[model samples]
Target: MKVLVYWAAVVVALALVAAAGGGQVAMAAVRCSPAELSSCASAITTASPPSRLCCRKLREQKPCLCNYLKNPTLGKFVNTPNARKVAAACRTPFPKC
Candidate 1:
Protein backbone atom coordinates (compact mmCIF):
# COMPACT_ATOMS: atom_id res chain seq x y z
CA MET A 1 0.00 0.00 0.00
CA LYS A 2 1.01 3.68 0.10
CA VAL A 3 2.67 3.22 3.50
CA LEU A 4 4.93 0.50 2.14
CA VAL A 5 5.92 2.70 -0.80
CA TYR A 6 6.65 5.61 1.56
CA TRP A 7 8.88 3.45 3.69
CA ALA A 8 10.77 2.29 0.62
CA ALA A 9 11.33 5.88 -0.46
CA VAL A 10 12.58 6.77 3.00
CA VAL A 11 15.04 3.90 2.93
CA VAL A 12 16.31 4.98 -0.49
CA ALA A 13 16.81 8.53 0.73
CA LEU A 14 18.69 7.31 3.77
CA ALA A 15 20.92 5.15 1.60
CA LEU A 16 21.73 8.11 -0.65
CA VAL A 17 22.65 10.24 2.35
CA ALA A 18 24.90 7.55 3.74
CA ALA A 19 26.63 7.08 0.39
CA ALA A 20 27.28 10.82 0.04
CA GLY A 21 28.66 10.98 3.58
CA GLY A 22 30.98 8.07 2.92
CA GLY A 23 32.36 9.81 -0.17
CA GLN A 24 33.15 12.89 1.92
CA VAL A 25 34.94 10.79 4.52
CA ALA A 26 37.04 9.14 1.83
CA MET A 27 37.87 12.48 0.27
CA ALA A 28 38.99 13.81 3.64
CA ALA A 29 41.37 10.95 4.17
CA VAL A 30 44.79 12.55 4.63
CA ARG A 31 46.10 13.05 1.09
CA CYS A 32 49.31 14.61 2.29
CA SER A 33 51.62 12.96 4.78
CA PRO A 34 53.63 14.64 7.54
CA ALA A 35 56.88 14.11 5.66
CA GLU A 36 55.55 16.29 2.84
CA LEU A 37 55.76 19.30 5.16
CA SER A 38 59.43 19.40 4.47
CA SER A 39 58.58 21.43 1.40
CA CYS A 40 57.99 24.32 3.76
CA ALA A 41 60.97 23.74 6.01
CA SER A 42 63.04 26.66 4.81
CA ALA A 43 60.18 29.06 5.32
CA ILE A 44 59.43 27.53 8.71
CA THR A 45 63.04 27.65 9.87
CA THR A 46 63.97 31.03 8.46
CA ALA A 47 60.75 33.06 8.67
CA SER A 48 60.55 33.46 4.93
CA PRO A 49 57.19 33.60 3.19
CA PRO A 50 55.96 30.26 2.03
CA SER A 51 56.02 29.39 -1.67
CA ARG A 52 52.91 28.51 -3.62
CA LEU A 53 53.85 24.86 -3.45
CA CYS A 54 54.43 25.18 0.27
CA CYS A 55 51.00 26.69 0.80
CA ARG A 56 49.33 24.00 -1.28
CA LYS A 57 51.12 21.30 0.65
CA LEU A 58 50.23 22.94 3.95
CA ARG A 59 46.55 23.04 3.07
CA GLU A 60 46.60 19.46 1.91
CA GLN A 61 48.38 18.42 5.08
CA LYS A 62 46.21 20.48 7.46
CA PRO A 63 44.42 17.45 8.82
CA CYS A 64 47.70 15.84 9.77
CA LEU A 65 48.75 18.74 11.99
CA CYS A 66 47.54 17.12 15.18
CA ASN A 67 49.42 13.95 14.39
CA TYR A 68 52.56 15.95 13.68
CA LEU A 69 52.19 17.73 17.01
CA LYS A 70 52.06 14.41 18.79
CA ASN A 71 55.34 13.34 17.21
CA PRO A 72 58.37 14.54 19.20
CA THR A 73 60.65 14.91 16.21
CA LEU A 74 58.06 16.69 14.09
CA GLY A 75 56.44 18.59 16.95
CA LYS A 76 59.48 20.78 17.57
CA PHE A 77 59.45 22.08 14.02
CA VAL A 78 55.67 22.39 13.68
CA ASN A 79 55.24 24.26 16.99
CA THR A 80 57.69 27.02 16.09
CA PRO A 81 56.72 30.67 15.54
CA ASN A 82 57.91 30.63 11.96
CA ALA A 83 55.85 27.54 11.25
CA ARG A 84 52.76 29.25 12.67
CA LYS A 85 53.36 32.21 10.40
CA VAL A 86 53.62 29.96 7.39
CA ALA A 87 50.47 28.13 8.34
CA ALA A 88 48.60 31.41 8.77
CA ALA A 89 49.76 32.56 5.36
CA CYS A 90 48.52 29.30 3.93
CA ARG A 91 45.19 29.75 5.78
CA THR A 92 45.65 26.44 7.50
CA PRO A 93 44.56 26.43 11.12
CA PHE A 94 47.09 25.08 13.54
CA PRO A 95 45.43 22.31 15.51
CA LYS A 96 45.26 22.58 19.32
CA CYS A 97 47.00 19.26 19.73
Candidate 2:
Protein backbone atom coordinates (compact mmCIF):
# COMPACT_ATOMS: atom_id res chain seq x y z
CA MET A 1 0.00 0.00 0.00
CA LYS A 2 1.06 3.60 -0.57
CA VAL A 3 0.88 4.42 3.10
CA LEU A 4 3.06 1.48 4.06
CA VAL A 5 5.61 2.37 1.46
CA TYR A 6 5.68 5.97 2.58
CA TRP A 7 6.20 4.99 6.19
CA ALA A 8 8.91 2.56 5.26
CA ALA A 9 10.66 5.26 3.33
CA VAL A 10 10.43 7.60 6.26
CA VAL A 11 11.92 4.98 8.56
CA VAL A 12 14.77 4.35 6.18
CA ALA A 13 15.44 8.06 5.83
CA LEU A 14 15.49 8.55 9.57
CA ALA A 15 17.84 5.62 10.00
CA LEU A 16 20.12 6.92 7.29
CA VAL A 17 20.19 10.33 8.88
CA ALA A 18 20.88 8.86 12.27
CA ALA A 19 23.66 6.63 11.00
CA ALA A 20 25.28 9.50 9.17
CA GLY A 21 25.45 11.83 12.13
CA GLY A 22 25.55 12.16 15.89
CA GLY A 23 23.00 13.60 18.37
CA GLN A 24 19.23 13.80 18.08
CA VAL A 25 17.53 13.35 14.70
CA ALA A 26 15.76 16.76 14.94
CA MET A 27 12.45 14.90 14.81
CA ALA A 28 10.43 15.24 17.98
CA ALA A 29 8.10 12.60 16.59
CA VAL A 30 10.50 10.02 17.98
CA ARG A 31 8.71 6.93 19.27
CA CYS A 32 9.41 6.50 22.97
CA SER A 33 9.30 2.73 22.97
CA PRO A 34 11.95 1.12 25.13
CA ALA A 35 11.87 -1.98 22.95
CA GLU A 36 13.83 0.08 20.43
CA LEU A 37 16.76 -0.51 22.74
CA SER A 38 16.77 -4.18 21.78
CA SER A 39 19.27 -3.34 19.06
CA CYS A 40 21.80 -2.58 21.79
CA ALA A 41 20.92 -5.54 23.98
CA SER A 42 23.63 -7.92 22.86
CA ALA A 43 26.26 -5.23 23.32
CA ILE A 44 24.77 -4.14 26.62
CA THR A 45 24.82 -7.66 27.96
CA THR A 46 28.29 -8.45 26.75
CA ALA A 47 31.51 -6.91 25.53
CA SER A 48 30.50 -6.87 21.91
CA PRO A 49 30.55 -3.63 19.98
CA PRO A 50 27.25 -1.91 19.30
CA SER A 51 26.04 -2.02 15.72
CA ARG A 52 25.18 1.12 13.77
CA LEU A 53 21.50 0.45 14.34
CA CYS A 54 22.09 0.11 18.04
CA CYS A 55 23.76 3.49 18.25
CA ARG A 56 21.07 5.05 16.14
CA LYS A 57 18.31 3.76 18.36
CA LEU A 58 20.15 4.83 21.46
CA ARG A 59 20.47 8.37 20.18
CA GLU A 60 16.82 8.41 19.20
CA GLN A 61 15.84 7.18 22.64
CA LYS A 62 18.03 9.58 24.60
CA PRO A 63 15.08 11.75 25.48
CA CYS A 64 13.32 8.80 27.08
CA LEU A 65 16.17 7.39 29.13
CA CYS A 66 14.93 8.92 32.36
CA ASN A 67 11.51 7.47 31.86
CA TYR A 68 13.02 4.06 31.22
CA LEU A 69 15.02 4.36 34.39
CA LYS A 70 11.88 5.28 36.27
CA ASN A 71 10.39 2.00 35.14
CA PRO A 72 10.95 -0.62 37.81
CA THR A 73 11.24 -3.42 35.29
CA LEU A 74 13.78 -1.63 33.12
CA GLY A 75 15.60 0.23 35.86
CA LYS A 76 17.92 -2.60 36.74
CA PHE A 77 18.94 -3.17 33.17
CA VAL A 78 19.44 0.53 32.49
CA ASN A 79 21.56 0.93 35.61
CA THR A 80 24.11 -1.71 34.82
CA PRO A 81 27.75 -0.87 34.06
CA ASN A 82 27.52 -2.89 30.88
CA ALA A 83 24.57 -0.85 29.75
CA ARG A 84 26.51 2.33 30.44
CA LYS A 85 29.39 0.96 28.45
CA VAL A 86 27.11 0.30 25.54
CA ALA A 87 25.77 3.84 25.73
CA ALA A 88 29.26 5.23 25.96
CA ALA A 89 30.29 3.22 22.94
CA CYS A 90 27.29 4.53 21.08
CA ARG A 91 28.30 8.04 22.20
CA THR A 92 24.79 8.26 23.63
CA PRO A 93 25.82 9.25 27.13
CA PHE A 94 23.98 7.43 29.89
CA PRO A 95 21.41 9.69 31.54
CA LYS A 96 21.90 10.81 35.11
CA CYS A 97 18.50 9.48 36.03
Q: lDDT of each structure? A: 0.66, 0.70
Q: What tens-digit string does per-residue lDDT give for candidate 1 at 1-97?
A: 5645553554454345334542122237764355456567667756779999999988887776776577564566578888899989988888897
Q: Which regions of candidate 1 deviate over 4 angstroms?
A: 1-27
Q: What TM-score would you give candidate 1 relative to the actual structure?
A: 0.66
Over the full model, what C-alpha lDDT does candidate 1 score relative to the true structure?
A: 0.66
lDDT tens per residue, model 2, 1-97: 5645553554455455335542133347875666667677667666589999999999988887887677665566678888888889888878986
Where does model 2 exceed 4 Å of error?
1-27
Please give the RMSD to the true structure for each candidate, in Å: 18.5, 10.6
Task: Give the local distance difference test score of model 2.
Answer: 0.70
